[model samples]
Target: MKVFKIVRVLFFISFFSFAQNEDYVKENYNKTETTITMRDGIKLFTVIYAPKDTSKEYPILLQRTPYSCQPYGEDAFRTKIAPNEFLMKEGNIVVYQDVRGRWMSEGVYDNMRAYIPNKKGKQIDEASDTYDSIDWLVKNIPNNNGNVGIWGISYPGFYATYSLLDSHPALKAVSPQASIGDFFFDDFHHNGAYLLSYWRVTPLFGHEKTQPTAKPWFNFPDLGTEDQYQFFLDAGPLSNLDAYYKEDNVFWQQLKDHPNYDDFWKSRGIIQHLKNVKPAVMFVGGFFDAEDLYGPFNSYQAVEKNSSNYNTIVFGPWSHGDWARNSERQSIGNVYFGDSISHTYQKNIETTFFNNFLKNNTQVTVKLPEAYMFDTGLNQWEQYEQWPPKNTEKKSYFLQNNQRLNTHAEKSFTFEEFVSDPKKPVPYSEDIKMVFTPRKYMTDDQRFAARRPDVLVFETPILTEDITMAGPILAKLKVSTTGTDADWVVKVIDVFPSDAADFPETQAYLKMDNYFMMVRSEVMRGRFRNSFSIPEAFIPNEKTAVSIKLQDVNHTFKKGHKIQVQVQSTWFPLIDLNPQTFVPNIFEAKATDFKKQTHRVYNDSSIEFTVLKKK
Candidate 1:
């Protein structure tokens, strides 16, 4: 045991050291700082790390981000540059830039800046900014091959996607990993429902800086207690947040102004503009990504539909940005996957992708699959010729009386009733502590929620055979609410066998005994069932059909594992509490709007799973 522990420690030490060694980056590359002027005469701060070898020219890899390109001075060096250490070793001229109006850049910052299709005079947007930046880098930067590639993880990923639109001639390849294509469906809002958990970042992007500074002008509110469920509940209606945010926060004000998806959000969506993509594009996302899952999937689909570009997608069983940062891809929270899964992806997929396009390396002949995804249940990587592979068949599981899920529809009319109270909303996870971003809740055990009177649980008989589900999940629910307005939260979970044992690595913190792991879930504002642009009231007790589209899932329920569905009106703190009463603007809803109401989900309702039938 002692010898094993020593070997394990040494393995990780060696793994990370080789992957992200600060000494290695500095020794091989020379760092230079420059301020590149945009089309509108706005100067943006940028950092360039060029290979010391003057014998050969290297391709320029750029990442534009709202997040600061830190270690400002030319003398100071970042811990590492490029997405992986292999790229640094391959000797590329990597660049990092602070977008206009952010961190030493002279301009104004617009949150998810609306793309300007037709620009006259000195007009500029993220796409134009990218063009100007790329054009400047290839021309001015020393010892740079004309070829350029752009990539970034989260917000930076958004910028990378923007680059694909009206791409520069020099831009050869681009990867947008966990990038948000639309704000309404991606980050702050999911299907027109506000993600209350992200309210913590109100100060991060909300505040307007008078000058280009290295540090954030504002600080996040320090919640006295770690229990966000209690904290948000005590705060009352969503309007209560105005007390802290005030009027100066433009982004928060925009949320209030745009109660419904309208021209404002439509203009900000980058997916529609992904037409005529010139560069070879790779869209990356995590299946369990709490944030921005909609972005990568939708962006890839849009490109595939509209543009004739070489596009592919990669999704792993990882949390937001986990594939890029985590060395231990073996598990997320209590769930244990195979070891070095992330390392394998980085070494095999990401590195090879860049080398083929940017470096023009013909030796790397590996053709990446069109859809390279990790099956969560099988815990292995699978490649498909097309996403939502042509082989899948749509299967419907009907919700029945007595907490049951069956393939056949129930002939008799029956319903499960739950009283939803805004004051005492359902907690998203069993854990009491507040997470700034509720990530683990994506795969959290649903036992606590199953026991809740307000949450309705429906389950299938233990699967006799492995049921593999791929692609999108649709929840067509026939629901009626006593109140005029409400929010419908649907969760698809995998129930572990009763005799299941915990893995050795997670024995201390996890127990698999009848564990209910959430596979895919989504929320829909009841008012927006018909249309997101306009909201309609429920008309009290009238039955309404709400179609809630859960994000794409590639999970398999192994034999003996039961597939479960959980339905609830409120997923508090994770999503802002719906007042229950109809309000034109939920952000401006009054305290009186918060009330207890009974919600009924009929047996006729069904969940559609894209099942991959075995040969």
Candidate 2:
């Protein structure tokens, strides 16, 4: 019996190679469903899949999305169609659409819409609906290749950064992963506060659909407790959670009618109109992207200071769209980060950034790095020709007199108190899980916020060699506040070495011995310090200077590890509690305007850090 016929021909060759990879897009694509139109005639709703291989021609890619581009009709295909799965098994036409008013599109949804600049007639936006959906998909699809490539992840990465503004000369290339450049500092405000963990994602962008649908018009709001910090501290203030969203959420009434940074958040800030940009951009994100890390580092430094074009940026050790997932041990919660880092960023940097600009006789020459990043305390992937890498060194530290963090300063002036208690605030996470915006508290373990006495810890002493740091952290608070509005937060930590070894992906009642990790953190809103369009309040005790910034980070601190620096003032419910009184609207405060006050920090409170210089 010839060994049962060679195990029945190796189980019929592994069941026909798992049915040709689960019906490779219904065995080599062809799924249509159109609409397109745009430039104000509206339409949108697309879908396409193409590729039946009429011997060649392909490249289209696109994405758009307001989330739903579901498996709707036209023989419902999509068990994965591009943007990974190695660009959905190479051979693109792909497309998805449904943007303008979202789902089956027709126009009306505006959250983050504002980008018009020189549009004549029907004044459309998302860069003229991505330049009229890449001019009707390179003039009506088919086995074509007029070349176009756009990607998305997170609000379709903000419409792949609005197709690099007024673009579409066959679009060329764009990435924008984990993007959202600014809903006031990337995803529901940061420097001006208010991110109660993105308040149940405001009914999927403040509901209001009436037609053209395939489903999910918007629902998520049954917050009846999973202890989301005692359901947002018993829903106190934020106008008692606006009765779980009253007047049918139009972006939660434009977040209670623009809580500042006016011009309705500087006209939906697409990174100050990412100037002259025209395709060939990358800008992916996640340095623990607890929601857009201020939109891919201010949209890759606003297209590297107003685009020369072919700009780039990667940043890994992901969290929000973990490099558009495929997963194989690339952890983030208990920190594991390696092994197929999102399938080596989809076979070497997103299929060589869309096969070196939408393949047409392509061999993919791969020359990326304008900053790839991902150190997260040395986990790996680095490369940079520029990106806070002008051989750094800004340094600063300070906050001294016992609890040190030195680099010298604090000759005499000393202060250090804390009280803060907006009814006992300060728990950004010890697994507060009710997440929508938590992302493992972006590399958590701050020793439960440095044993919170309303946090203010500040160490340094042990690291004798490896420090690294690399870019953007400012902080600079010489404070005082007996309640007149406050929020501060600023983290940074690294600590580790108490014989640190717990990684089997840690967390089993944790133990990386002296772990404290949390590489970077932010949250400002001390009445927007001087102005996020005029906020100024803390005059109660007056030391006032403030500053904050805190976003970029490459991280190393290794030698014996220590670095620290906590400083806090209620990061509870992750922003939105700062009612130390000043009210023109702390989203309509008044629970006795949240009292408990005290707060101080001076010792010439410093911080700065760009460091990185040992080549």
Candidate 3:
């Protein structure tokens, strides 16, 4: 009865305002702020907006973001328009809700996604809350047409995905934009490998628990947001961290709980349960999206293969958040596409997906699906029927004499050895930013790593013809480790012009840090490579074979350019200081736990990429 009353009151206001279909402005909408009580008595705060001129009820467009919910249509830190463009002009009731345990919302924020599973199955999640939230929104919100949609980027994107598992029937659309589907694959954990630098800096964003309570958290300038001052101050030899740790920092604890791909992570994975998906979905990602590239693609593939759901994917040469709005083309590390690719795409590509599905926008008739790629040189979007074209064939170039990547094999090759000491890891200066710093895996660069002695480089012969590679790149080689634990980093490089005046020669190369993270950063724990669930020690003098899966790449190595792969044992502080000991937790290792490890490259067991070609 209360819901009906709310609907009637809104209908009367909506009917009177429908007299004019004028251009919509920010203030022309009505908003309601509420601390909604869930079925479980959990109070989740939400900000709702409705089109003033609601002739017919509008579909509800919801975004569950931890980034906080501000007034709809107001200038947000994102600076992008909410109610998005298609929603604003086309008009829909937009709702932004803060997840439990963060901001003004109630309940312990589990960082929602990462949780160690219980042997007896005890766990609380965002999906249940999302269901509760949706149940209330559909029944309570006035002028809501039952149809609903949700979307977000990065951390918030994780919420969007979490909401879909046991979704409300009203949720007809959802776009998990650049979300990290598997925490271990990206984010805190990279390919089971630890992303220490990113982890070290992330807790700063969680409310003020990690802050100095005595000193207002706001007063202290944040590292990335403010300047480098805080970063240096926080990590300097004098900083004490216990004063900062908070309950909301579940992600930090999460790293400790799920040491392997056990039930803990398995329970959080929804890609496997993506059956009978009732919503029209849009999985958004950036072609160059470093952190969550695996998420969107992996999720899309799972949805496509696991279930017969209606879905679409849109990817441009973008970063973690760039896909959300129009902005500068380049992100960090001086990585730039030709121009403002985001602006050219913002004319309602994303908003259209939500509007067309949620509001049933008639303006959107035909839609595109599958992975879309934006060619760097061409500066255009191309739709692929599938990733790693089924028609393509595999081409392997072996690591040969010296640093030359060769189709021609070198029969006699000696073993190469280098000491991988975590304590004195490479610094993050010049081109070696990845060596010591943690960046949201997006930008691509190799100039700084091309000359590192620790990194063994291999190059393919100068090509008379162009080679087209459209698939996941893999590094298959004979590998061995002298110590209890070791890390092998591999990178794929696009050998461009060598500062020649002829063509302004410059090409992008994947560094060892990225390669290792992309391919097999999934933790081997060294002791568990033979099995993530089982434990075993490595044979010190044994030569073993390890295949590192380079993150997927789509490229047409143009003429005169070369393809190269670099191998190194340690990515250092960029990744955690892997103490060279295969202990339960390397964090507890002693100073003497560090050891220098050796690796070898051989002709019989050479480094090669499994390529796809037009078979």
Among these predicted structures, which one has the highest lDDT? Answer: 1
lDDT by residue (tens digit), candidate 1, 502-601: 8764436568889899999999999999999999999888888999998899999999999999999989889998888888898988998788999999
Cα deviation of 249 in candidate 3 (Å)?
Answer: 5.2
lDDT: the better of candidates 1 and 3:
1
Q: What is the lDDT of candidate 1?
A: 0.86
Off by over 4 Å in 3: 1-25, 71-80, 113-124, 202-251, 328-332, 361-364, 408-414, 427-445, 499-528, 604-615
Best by TM-score: 1
Instruction: Estimate, for each residue in 1-615, the C-alpha lDDT of model 3 and write its tens digit.
Output: 242232223211111121123434445577677777766677888877777786779888777765456433333212223524445566777777877765667765554454322212334567776777888889998878888888777766777776667667888778888776776666666555665556444453443333111121221122343222234224422112323444455554555656676777766665665655656677877656556777877777777776666677777766556644445443434444555566555454666676666766433455754566665423457667766456666667777657777665556755665566564454322332321133433333454555666667777767687676666666666656776666666666666645322211122443322221111122233554566555455567577766666656666566766677767765544555555666665534555666666656554445444354543
Q: Per TM-score, what order, best first? A: 1, 3, 2
Better of 1 and 3 by TM-score: 1
Q: What tens digits encode model 2's per-residue C-alpha lDDT throughout 235-257?
A: 88888888778888799988888
lDDT, model 1, position 134: 88
- How many pairs of residues collide in each model? 0, 1, 16
For candidate 3, give the lDDT.
0.57
